[model samples]
Target: MNQLERLRKYTTVVVDSGDIECITRYKPQDATTNPTLILKSVLSKKYDFIVNNAVQYAKKMGGSISQKIQNASDMVSVGFGAEILKYIPGYISTEIDARLSFNTEQCIQKSIKLIDLYRIHGVDVSRVLIKLAATWECIQAAYQLNKLGILCNLTLLFSFAQARACAEANVFLISPFVGRIYDWYKKFCLDSSYDAVTDPGVLAVKKIFKYYKKHMYQTIIMGASFRRIEQILELSGCDRITISPDLLEQLKTQNFSFARKLDATKIVTVVDQPIPLSESEFRFLHNQDAMAVEKLSEGIRQFSCDQIKLEKFLLHTL
Candidate 1:
């Protein structure tokens, strides 16, 4: 079997895009969409109707751009996700507003609103994993949401502390960013100063994976934001991998066995360790972790920016 087939035995492949057609080719187990992906899709000629519907939604509001913009955001997500849900048998992740990442209560409230919106159209809540940022507030929100029978995908994770916090809080899953870490090292390093053998992102995920394994945390690890096929291959045994369509297509063309690279059984840690993190401890852990802090902020900003672009598209179409 080829690498994709070989990797399938150990990992659940998830397509990371908004276009259902793009995802159908690889037959990923699940699919994920952020504001960026949806915004990009609406801009493309093939999905212009998404923009049209969102624009009509905005025009009906007939208010300030802010109000219409807010409506536009929701409409885009619901519109794209409604269509995107058809190709995958599993869940489709729909992210909440990134600007709400710091407000635990509002994040939960908005996520619930999103779920209710989806349900109004006969979409099953079980097939939707509300995506939230890995900020302390977002995780807390996910914790509460999970209690309310809502599953969440904690995203923008780049540190072991973030993973530990998410797992400790019993969040459903975490998306450890790989491409952004690679980008950071590539931009910072001189020639020959970097190696995928010791890539910082790889090390981050490995640390989190080992800790999760050692502690028997059930929170799934879905590696995201990969820059290359090698990084995906390196994370072969992760709980799930969300790959972009281009990378998924490339993997389909490759011929070779992709052996599992990270088996938790190979680790030598002898004792089961308990993480004693109260609110104070969780804050301390989150504060001390720079990657989680910085990247979480940056990711939210980028996603929020995409939301703005999507709103602009809605206005012009109106």
Candidate 2:
């Protein structure tokens, strides 16, 4: 078997793209997308139909320009998600707007509306994982949604506090980013000894995974934003991993034996009690870690920027 097949023996591979061809080629169990991926996809000729359809649908709706933009953006997200679901049997993570990341009520309402769009397109709720930024309020929103049987995939998670909060809140899954963390360390940290095995990003996920296993938390830990196949390979045996098509292709071409890097047998113990990550505690923890604070803020800004660009593209399509 190729490296990808070997890796799948222990980890659940998720395609992190909206490109239908790559999804077909890699055949990952699940797929994920956000404003960034959807924006890139809408510009591709292959996905023009999705953008055009969303624009046409929103034009016929009775609403203000701002409302229409929101509607069209959501439609495009759902449209791409539904299309992706056609090929992957597991689930497609459809992100709620990043702008709603800090507003619990709005996040909950928008998530419900997005799920409704999936159902309208004949996709089952179980096949959809609502993606939310792992802010304090969003964690609470995930708790609310989880109680109502809606699964959530919390993104932009960086600090241990975020993971703890999400797990405590009964979130379905948390995506601790590896590549972005690595990028931050590379740029700021003077210690250049960090390799894939000791990569800050990889270590972050490992710490979270160990803590979850030791505590027997039911929330899943899916490592995200990998910069290298080495990072993905090192994270083998994580509950799930969302990978880009480029790295997925690299894994497919290389041949190697895969070892299970994370498992229940290797439980990680926390020295202290479960961390309290209330709004105040969350803010304090973030303030202490400059990397986490900067990365989380940058992540939100990037996603929100893509979201605005997408809205404009949809509006222009009219």
Candidate 3:
């Protein structure tokens, strides 16, 4: 078996792309999209029909221009998600607006709106995982949404604090970013060469995985934003790993001896007394990880910028 096929034996390989063609080719079990990816796919114009349909839906809603733009953006996101779902069997992670990351109520409302759109498209709402930044507010928002049976995939997760908070909130999944963490350390420590075992990003996910398994937390850990195939290989047995199309292609073409690197059943160590974090504790502990703080803020700003650009693109189309 090729590396990709072998990897699938242990991990549910998820395609992290908004491009439907790539999704069709890779055939990942799940697909994930952020504003940047959506913007890239929309701009490619291959899916102009999807964009136009969203525009019409937004116009028929008959709101003010700003509200219309927001509606259209949400529609476009769901439109891609619905299309993606046609090819993949598992789930599609549709993100909420990054601008609402710090606002719990707005995040919850946006998630509801997205889920409603998915339902309107005849897609199963249960197959949609609302993606949100792992801010304290978003975690709280996920808590309430989970109670309502709306599954969430908390993104931009960097620290154990974020993962712990999400698990405590009963979040369905948490995407601990591997590449961004490695990027921060590579620049801050002025070193770029590290093998998979020594990679800081790999180590971060391992720590979180061990802790979660040891405590028997049911929240799924999906290692995300990998910088290399080695990183993905190192996290072979994670619950899920969202890999970009480029890396997925590499895995499909290459041959490698693969082994399960993270097995929950193998985790035996348990903490003496584990306690959930308070809001203040979560913030302080998250803050102590400078890499997490910087990367979380930077990831949000980057996504929000693309989201704004996408809005402008939709406005121009309208």
List CA RMSD, all candidates.
2.4, 1.8, 1.2
Q: Name the better of 1 and 2 by TM-score.
A: 2
Task: State the TM-score for model 3.
Answer: 0.98
Candidate 1 weakest lDDT stretch, 10 residues: 188-197
Q: Which digits, one per residue and each the tens of the lDDT, describe model 2 over residues 187-280?
A: 9888856878999999999999888888878898999999899999999999999999889889989997878888877675554557556788
| lDDT string, candidate 3, 1-318, tens digits | 999999999999999999999999999999999999999999999999999999999999977999899999999999999999999999999999999999999999999999999989998899999999999999999999998889999999999899999988889999999999998888988667789999999999999998889888889999999989999999999999999999999999999787889998888966553777999999999999999999999999999999999999988876
Note the Cα lDDT for every prediction shown: 0.83, 0.89, 0.94
Ten consecutive residues with minimal summed lDDT in candidate 3?
Answer: 267-276
Model 1 over residues 125-206: C-alpha lDDT tens digits? 8889999999889999999999999999999887676788899899999999988877776676575255656777877887
Q: Rank the candidates by TM-score, best first.
A: 3, 2, 1
RMSD of 2: 1.8
**Which parts of model 1 have CA positions greater than 4 angstroms off?**
55-65, 189-192, 265-273
> What's the C-alpha lDDT at position 146 in model 2?
92
Error of 3 at 196 (Å): 0.8
TM-score of each: 0.91, 0.96, 0.98
